[model samples]
Target: MTTRPGRGRPKASDGADRRTALVDAARRLFAERGFAATSVRAVAREAGVDAALVSHYFGDKQGLLVATMALPVDPAARIREVLDGGRDGLGERLVRTFTETWDPHEDVIAALLRTAMTGDPEQAPALQLARAVLVVGVREQLQGPDADGRAALVAAQVVGLAVTRYVARLPHVRDLTPGDLARVYGPAVQALVDGN
Candidate 1:
């Protein structure tokens, strides 16, 4: 009686699928319970995997949260698109860029922000991931004789806009039409990038 190579455990072919399942489960649970309340063991249970598997795959709860919150869109590609035009037009470009990219239905960027405020260890990983990915990207474009200060300024403004528009849902702020946003807020963003 010949048997397949694998014995007790399922084949590694399913590992990728299982990891994906784990991340999905973790995202749902994290959103429902908040990062502090969710446990790795619970995530594993939800994913129908061994608890150790969760650790093995994600390292810890924080790792799992970061993995779970990853954006489907490629951030580098998005950043490149936003920064493509004349550097002087960067503020308008950034506002338009985020308005287009941060579709509530397309990616859970806002949801991640909501959880990030909790300051939980689990949440920290994801927050750090976002800060590193976003700040560094902006910093990269800004790091130069003329752009260094502008980049930092622009990054701060972008963060503030995201908080006001999405996380806080400030009605007046959020209600601004894209065109109006460009007209009103564009200067602020430009100031950030322009070192004004």
Candidate 2:
């Protein structure tokens, strides 16, 4: 007699599918139940995988939350890349980065932005993920007494750009090319970074 498929921990070839299942489950539950209310065990059950896989794949619930964002590139790593380019044209770089990262994944990122806009950051996983991914990521990479303030300001700019351009799909902002938007918005972000 032969056993059925997908009844246990997936084989190496199935790893990607297993991971996708967990992310899909987490995304659905996070939307329906809210992030804080969802549990790793519930996600595992929803995905039809062992609870240990969540820990193995994501390190924790917070990591799973970040994974749900599902951008093609890693946000923190990309943030570091821009930060490495230094303060010169940093604002343009930031605008370019934000647009490039979210443009292809507007539906996913827009949902995250709405969660942030409507939910309390303290209780919302999506907002916490935003702070941890963008705000804290930026803050940790900079120096000086104003680093925290600068990071928060930059985060605000990035968030506004996301809401207006992606979520709201504003005609003027959404119609511009990434390069064009960077040129228009970068100076303001750069000003914040330069503490002007």
Count the clashes in each prediction: 0, 0
For model 2, the stretches where C-alpha displacement exceeds 4 angstroms are 1-69, 119-127, 140-147
Q: Encode model 2's per-residue lDDT on 17-85: one tens digit a residue.
A: 878889988877776566777888999889877888899999988889878865565667777787778
Model 1 residue runs over 4 Å out of place are 1-33, 38-67, 105-107, 115-147
lDDT agreement of model 1 with the native: 0.70
- Model 1 pairs in collision: none
lDDT of 1 by residue, 163-186 (tens): 788657789778886667877899
Can you give the lDDT of residue 14 in candidate 1? 49
For each candidate, the alpha-carbon lDDT, in order, equals: 0.70, 0.77
